[model samples]
Target: MMNPAPALPRLAIHYCTGCRWLMRAAWMAQELLTTFEKELGEVALVPGHGGVFRILCDDELLWDRKIDGGFPDIKALKQRVRDRIAPGKALGHSETAAH
Candidate 1:
């Protein structure tokens, strides 16, 4: 194992309504969280206010990403999370919370 990398950036994903894709997205978020922890230490992938899973990092603005479309929308979601984390880094790592 290697020492954790510098704090690249923070990311937060928010899902508003309860939908089938919501859970799917949550799983995807989990996968991202595990994969990116090396570059972005102490990241958070949490289920937001309304059963909405969110990924929170240093960038507070990222908390506002509300993805409506499911599954296929993951690409966009990943982009947004990547944008929030840092340009070069990837996504997958998250801090989970039930809401």
Candidate 2:
């Protein structure tokens, strides 16, 4: 018998309408989905307020705009998500130098 693979993580991106974070949030979602298509279960866009921009994976908070003092770099965000959901996976150039 072989061991089963872990369940794919669910990512939720919450962006504030008041701050016009839709494009940023959507772009991040697109990048994550494209990069981790097979590893991620889903990426949900959630509307929010008060300059809120957060990324949650499997109900765990991964990034926060206000808390982190600004938006996250897409590559960094990918690493963060990958660390939690697919620790053994490599992000290739995204994790290399010059970033």
Top-scoring candidate (TM-score): 2
Candidate 1 runs further than 4 Å off: 1-25, 45-48, 51-54, 63-72, 89-99
Residue 41 in candidate 2 has what lDDT? 89
Please provide, for model 2 over 33-89, each residue's C-alpha lDDT reduced to its tens digit, 9 standing for 90 to 100.
999999998999999998899999999999998898899998899999999988999
What residue runs in model 2 are displaced by over 4 Å at the alpha carbon? 1-7
- Write one digit per residue (lDDT tens) for candidate 1, span 4-31: 8554655545554454345655676675
The deviation in Å at residue 54 for candidate 2 is: 0.5
**Per-residue error (Å), model 1, residue 24:** 4.3
Q: How far is candidate 2 from the true structure (C-alpha RMSD, Å)?
A: 2.6
